[model samples]
Target: MKRRTKIVVLGSALLLTAGAASAATASEAPSPRGAAVSEAPRPHEAAAPETDRPREAAALTGTAKLHRSAGDDITFSFDAHLAAKDKADPMKATGTFAFSHYQNGDGARAEVAVDCLLTGGKVAVVSGIVTESDLPGVEGKRVGVTVHDLGRHDRLGYSWAATGTPAEMDGLPKCVSSAPFEKVAKGTGDFTVVPWQPEF
Candidate 1:
């Protein structure tokens, strides 16, 4: 064949091959825009099993002792003066704590509280309050913690109410970045007294 004729034949062959490949791609289903939808596994591995949930926590010894003065016209030895930047806090008063298996993810919490009777613009009588609950994987044991309602005066009142465990403080302080005395400038810098920790 002539040189020019050979060149024409080669180009035609290339075009035919390209056309066939395009036709094949067009016949396939188009993938949606997001992650490829993969079916859940047979056992479904995302949500934790209902039975896997931890049982209530067991009772333990806990305390909340403050080492500073707050402006509440009521200062107790353990009356917490915290200033939480995140989550709803319920420390309405002040004192020590030791609680377990908190319920009401954002409503109720586990804790122990204590304070002295208000006297001379300060609390003078030390008393205690405790919240009780059970721990997961543990039975016949009741855990408690002392709590103060710091959220009483909050305009945005408590929103972050979760349980905590003293063993590891599972998800307590880390829920928000703060100390026990984030509210009281007088004692905030020098004092520290918290109420509870999330369960394990």
Candidate 2:
């Protein structure tokens, strides 16, 4: 016709440039061995942080009967045990502290062993040393006591209650105590003191 219409329009422009160069070489191929090809999506992960814990050590028994200032009449007891807050020896405690004293016929009795124990709530502050004694010169010496349960009016104090003269207090070192004041004319029991923490 007009030269076969220009050779059929140059073979339809070389079959439209070989179908766009075979779709740019199959989009730059690379994905055949078990091909699944299709990925782009990932991002999500982050969380973790919180910690703090440590504290426990407290126990001091009781048996009271204190009333000083003139009538004199002491008789306190406790079976202590405390020391473990990372313990660098908060006086490292153990147990035992039994005392007795009268006034009329003059009396004395002692037995300490524990070593430093301090509390805050029900109040407590026990020192120790006197292994055993009939009270004279306070056996080995190194006492300290102070209670204050106060439910039925419990209270006591003695570093050797009113010893020698001017309100003496012949022993007191480790954790030196004092602050149950005094006053427990005659109690039966229940002074389970508990509260404790770096407190003095």
Report every candidate's CA lDDT: 0.25, 0.58
Q: Whole-model lDDT for model 1 versus the true structure? A: 0.25
Off by over 4 Å in 1: 1-108, 111-131, 134-165, 168-180, 184-200
TM-score of each: 0.17, 0.30
- Tens digit per residue, CA lDDT, model 2, 1-200: 23211110100001011123342333445656886874533443222223334434665676656555655455666877685563445477787767665556555566678777877788888787767665445566676777878766887665544443111345357857555666676455456787676644
Pairs that collide in candidate 2 are none
Top candidate when judged by lDDT against the true structure: 2
User: Where is model 2 poorest over a 10-residue stretch in terms of lDDT?
Assistant: 7-16
- Top TM-score model: 2
Count of clashing residue pairs in every prediction: 53, 0
